[model samples]
Every structure is written in C-alpha cells, then in structure tokens.
Target: MTWRRALSVALALALALLLLLVVYDRPLRLMPWRKRSAQPEAAERRTNRGPALATLGRGKGDGVDLFKGEPLLGEEHIFFVETSCALDKPQHVPYDSESGLRLSPRGACAVEAAAAAHPTHRVYLVHTCDVHRRSLAKDAAPAYALAALSIPNVRLWAVPYALHFVGTPLQGWLASGALRASRWPVVHASDVLRFLLLWKYGGTYLDLDVLMLRSLGEKKNFGCAESPAAVSVGAFNFALDDPGRRVANACIAELLDYRPDLWSYNGPGAITRALKKVCDVQEVLEMTEEMCGGFRLLSTSTFYAIPWQNWNLFFTEESSEEIMMMIGKNLAVHVWNALSHNTTIYTSSEQPYAQIARRVCPNVVAAVGDTM
Candidate 1:
C-alpha cells in the first residue's frame, strides 16, 4: 500500500483500540473482584488489631487523646447542607408556620428525636450559609430549622457562608491511580469542621441525611457497615474522646495547610485508623434487613464499612424498599432521597416520619410524642 494508505490504516486501528479500551474499562475493573472472607479468625484479629487503651463501658478501650480533651455526649450541632448535587428545583422549600419541608424530614427527625430522646444529648441543626449554591436556592436551612423546632429537642446553628470549591488544588498533582483521588475535600472540610466544633464544645456529629433508630450507647461497638444492605461508617457517630478529636482536628488542619487535596480528605478514616492502632474494635452489631430495608449498620472485619460501596448497594429498587421498611422497623424510615418528594406537608410537617417512628419505635415515639 502507498504510505498515505498505510498511515490511514494505522490511525483507524489506533482509534478502534482506544474505543475498545474505553468500552471494557468498567467491566475490567469490576471483574475478578474478590469477596471479603468473613472468617472467625479474621474477625477476631480485626477486633483486637489496635493496641490496648483505656476501657470504656462496652468493653472497648479508649486509648490516646484524639481530641484535645472533651466530653463525649452533649448538645451536638447536626448540619445537612443540601449540597449543590442533592437539591432539586426549589431554591428553598417553604416552611409553613406549622411543619417543615418533606424532603429532609427523616434526617431532621432523627436529630430532633435523638436529642429529645436523650436530653443530655443535644443536637443542633447546622446549615451552610452559601446561598448562591449551584443546585438549590438559599433558605433551605431556615425552612428545615422551622420544622425541626417543633420536635422540642432539636436546635439550629448556622455557619458563615463560604465559596464552594470547583475542585481542590491537590487534584492536579495527584495521579488517578492514587487513593487520594476518591477523597472529597470540600465536603470533608465541612464535615471535619463540624466535628471539631462538636469536640471542642463537647457534643456529637451527625449527617442530616441519616435517620437514627437506636441509641448510640446501646449499640456500643463502632465498626463500618455497608448501608442500605450495610451502613458504612463515613462521618457518622463517634464519642468525642480527646485523642480522636485531636486526630480529626489535625486531619482537617493538615489538609488546609499541607495536601490542599479534597480527594485525600478522610476525616473518619483518619480517626478510625489512628484509634484502630491503639484501641480494640468492639463487636459490630448487625442492622438486619428487618430493621434496615436497604441500609443497615453491617458487620465487617474492618472498623467501618466502605461508604461508596455501601451506598451503591442502596441504588437498586430491591435495596431501597427493603431499607425503607427496615428503617420503619428498627430506626425511623430515613428516606435519604427526601428531596425527591414533591408533596407538601402543611398541617404538621413531622407527621410522615413521626408516624413511622410511632409504629416502629413506639416507646420512643410515646416518650417524645407529647413533646412533638
């Protein structure tokens, strides 16, 4: 063939090869996936993998001072920003003088109910002050707070607005092959800052999107579960011990000064890793399908379940309904996809989740019902 013809043939082959690579990339990554073994020996090793620290009530040791020095339970400020991604068309849903938006009710209820259920445990709702957020309009927080106030135990806190990052500086320098690529720094920073505030003030941290079915103290042990099918420990419940808090604070502080990469931001991962080195991981209680529908705090050999994997398990139709019912059974039905709901609850906003809470956790509902 002529030289021009040969060049054209080579280009066509290269294009075909590139297209083939792209098509098969996902399957290739998914194939040959190893199932994690749940051997008894492995579980035992993981349980005791960390060093011996001071023992707490649940036969778990509280070693090293993670936080500077602080109390574990108190008035925790729980904030859920309707991240640019999570919100729907509304700038902010209307807050009737009576009830709140139906979108984030369950999460709001969890904080409010948990706070009311345990007076010693205070939970304040925190919202990002960023009004010009890409997705939803501002006032969503205020609307949410109005509904939450009806619950008696819930309080509201607001952070000064800050600009949302398009991407952290660290992304450019890091290779996709590196672990840091998976990290979400802006979101992590917000979460970590909240935790720092909780630790410094002596309280707990909770994501607004999650529902609380049982008492953290009752659960005792801390291990990640795959949510929906299993709840992964992302930035969820943890007692604010000095060392743990310090580790969290240090992680965020370090990110601000050093890495400047959002992808490497692992708040819970950092604290859990540090604690695992010195403390025993307690027995992970299973949040079964009966109580967890698609989501449950699953039993894993590791300290916490992987969030991405666990949440992906939540997307299926089978997983979603199962998790919803389970939440109705064990905890309140969370409805993580609350923003998707289009109806307005005008009379009493808390009624939907409250009805489920009454049915599932009757005693808790009875106790807090009058308050509501």
Candidate 2:
C-alpha cells in the first residue's frame, strides 16, 4: 500500500511538470540525446520563415562592405543599380500604394529573372540612397523588393555617393555639384555611378529594365553594341583588376567633362568614346577580341532585340511571337523602359512583355496581379 502511494505521487508530479513545460512553450525531451533531433525542426522553422534581408553592413571610409556577413564579391556577382529615389512614386509603371518604396513590377521582374537565371551568382540590387540613414523595415518594404529579397542569392543594398565615389575621379566632380548642373540629373547620375561601380567592383552591371534569359557564363570585359557604332551602357562587365581597367578608367575620366544638355552623350556616348580610345570603333561590328583589346562587343540582338523605335512591340499583342523568336537565342532582352514607360502592361493580355514576366518572375507577377 505504501509503495503504491509513492508511485502515484511521482506520476502526479511528472504530470504537473509536463503541464508547466507546455505553458512555457518549451519542448519536453524525455531523453537528453533527443535534443539533437530537435535541431531539424528548428532548422525547418527557419527555412519556412525565408531568408533575412541582407542589407546589414557597416560603411567604411571611401568604400562600403556591400554584404557584411555574406560571401565576398567574386566573379559570381551580378549588379543592378537603381538610382531613382522616387521608388515609392514610380513614373514608369503603375504605382501600387501597398508596395511601399519598391521597384515597379517590371523592374522587379528584371531583377528576379537575373537571380533565377543564375542561381549561383549573388545578384545585388544596389540603390543610390544614403545608406547610413535609410534602413527599410521588412513590413514597410514594398512587395517587389521583398519578393526579390526572398530569393536565396539576391541581396538589397543602399549605397551613398560619398562612400562609393570617394577614391575615384568622380569624387571631385560630385563634390563640386557638377552633377546638379545636368538637365537630367538622375539619368546622368546613373551614367556616372555605373562607370564608378564597374571600375571599383569589377562585376556585371545591368540596368533595371534588362531581363535575363541565360547565364552570362565566363564572359567578362564586354559590352553589347546598341548599333554598329554605339555601345549600350545598359549592360556591361569589366574586371576589377583587369590590368588598369582601360575602358572603365577611360569612361570615369571622361565623366569629368560630362555634358548635361545632350541626353545620350553621357550614357551611350561615353562608352562609345572609351571604346574608340582602346580600339577602332568600326571593328566593333566584327566583335573580334583584338578589336577592343580583348573586350568582346556583343551584337545588338543579344540585348536590344526589340529596337527602341519598335519598343511598343513589347506591349502590342501582334508582335508577341515575333519578339519572342528574336530573343530566343539572346542572353537577355532589354524592355526599353525609357520608351515604353507610358505603355500599359495588361497582365491578362498576350503581350511579349507580360508573357516574359509571367515566365521569368512569376513571384512578382503573382504579387502585383492584374494591376501590372
């Protein structure tokens, strides 16, 4: 009778302990070795929560730690620069109030397509904002940015001009407010920053409007020709330590004499001028390695498959199949957002742009829905 009473008391105490553990939300491990088994459950919870935004980094003098704790920048880095500070009020695409300071649906699709195409590369979406001041909370960030950030290899960063341009020749030009003198300050600023970014980082820099169709693969130190005589600055790659960075160095140096009145002069014109200094501009049509001192000039079809003159073809239902076939072999397709900004994209429509968005950046397409 005494032994039976003792056993009952022990059972009652165990039940109370189990109840307390449940109330406190602590798992009860009956065996100490089972603690190791719980690790998988914890890991699964983290996996379900998705990756945290990789915007955390300390700004060093003259340069930035783009991704503080992540892997270092190697050849596997792809860059997309967003110079527009009016992200919340996008001028090009339909604005959604719920998205909060995110890129337009089209812009986000460009980035997500790049990330999805090259899963191994760390795709960085760098914004030209003052990094020290602007830190976007997860809930407050727009859906496009959040959706892009959800990709495992994608990272978002806000870069300050002072930090990024410190050691370069553009430092003086920027400090003197020469950039403000431009008729199109934002466009000109984008031109200046792209040159500086490539010179300093030596990786691929893509415009927010360019959609990726394939991996760039070992191709470095190259630019796609927008025409027989002009090189498109929208998509270009240069190595950081490529023995003096001839083209990049030349472009940065030319920016000091930047002309504000002429629109394309500072953007496409700058690269065209730089290539001339390195190699014969006429040879660019041949795309020979020796033509530009080992710089490969890709054909226009590689990027600008749909010429700006026919930019509306992307939106027109009639040109959808023709445009798709044109860009089938190309590495990417430039949506020509500059000309197509006013053109509306009907999600339900069979336009090539909408179809590409659905195929490449489905997450963004789904998030924005029929509004895009």
Per-model lDDT: 0.37, 0.70
Which ten contiguous residues of candidate 2 have the minimum total lDDT? 43-52
lDDT of 2 by residue, 1-372 (tens): 699999999999999999887876644433222232222332112211112222332233322222322124344778877666422222333333332344677888888999999998888777654332233332344565567766777766553444556556777887887766777776877888788777866888899899998889878888988987788999999876553298888888778788979898888888888777777654456646686777878878889888888888889898789878887878988988878877888877899988888888888888777857
lDDT of 1 by residue, 1-372 (tens): 999999999999999999999999977764322222244232112111111111111112412111111122333433343322211222344332221222244444555556654554445544433232211222333333334443444433322313122133333322232322324433544444454444344344555545555555533223244322323333344335544454344334433433335433344344433333233332223333222222223344222221333443333344545444443434322333334234332222234443444533343333333423
Q: After superposition, how far is residue 348 of candidate 1 from its true place, in Å?
A: 14
Judged by whole-model lDDT over C-alpha atoms, candidate 1 comes out at 0.37
Q: What is the TM-score of each candidate against the true structure?
A: 0.42, 0.76
In lDDT terms, which candidate is top? 2
Candidate 2 has a TM-score of: 0.76
